[model samples]
Target: MKSRHVIFPSLMIIFGALSLYFISQFAEPRFQDASVDAKFFS
Candidate 1:
């Protein structure tokens, strides 16, 4: 039971890193993103 407490956080960090890696790999980068951010800020 005590071992699981350590294992859970480690697994969570690994999975979170993997998800971010794939998202950055295939995600689109566009110039229009500045337009969206401007709208959000203003």
Candidate 2:
């Protein structure tokens, strides 16, 4: 039971890191339009 607590949080942290990495890759700029383009936050 104690091990379950540690494992769950570790898995969540790993998944979050992976998600951010992919988002950054997909948000790369590909156009001159400052108002419309792939962005991490827009």
Candidate 3:
């Protein structure tokens, strides 16, 4: 196998995980608010 093939996939996986982590962090507050609204409205 070539090094480019391995490096690209490795970088992609690392970036994917980081993006997911940041997304979850950013989304957590919205999710909390949604849940609170659900509780109050229901």
Candidate 4:
């Protein structure tokens, strides 16, 4: 049946979730102030 084509949404959800996770994993945290010395101590 043509209903078998419904796999696209499932694939999209899976890929979207993975993409979000991968993006967050590589995202750099921005500091509110660049003068913070805690960044260097960490």
The global C-alpha lDDT for each of the candidates, from Candidate 1 onward, is 0.75, 0.76, 0.82, 0.67
Q: Which digits, one per residue and each the tens of the lDDT, describe model 1 over residues 6-28?
A: 99999999999999998666544
If ranked by TM-score, best first, what sequence of candidates would result? 2, 3, 1, 4
Pairs in clash, predicted candidate 4: none
Comparing 1 with 4 on TM-score, the higher-scoring candidate is: 1
lDDT tens readout by residue for model 2, 1-42 = 999999999999999999999878765654334545635355
**lDDT, candidate 4, residue 15?**
100
Query: For model 3, how does the per-residue alpha-carbon lDDT over 1-42 read when each residue is reduced to its tens digit?
Result: 699999999999999999999977787677677887546644
Q: Count the backbone clashes (under 3 Å) in each candidate.
A: 0, 0, 0, 0
User: Best TM-score goes to which candidate?
Assistant: 2
Best by lDDT: 3
* lDDT string, candidate 4, 1-42, tens digits: 566678887889999999999866654453334546337635
- Candidate 1 error regions (>4 Å): 29-42
- The RMSD of every model to the true structure, in order and in angstroms, is 3.9, 3.2, 5.5, 7.4
Prediction 2 global C-alpha lDDT: 0.76
Clashing pairs in 2: none
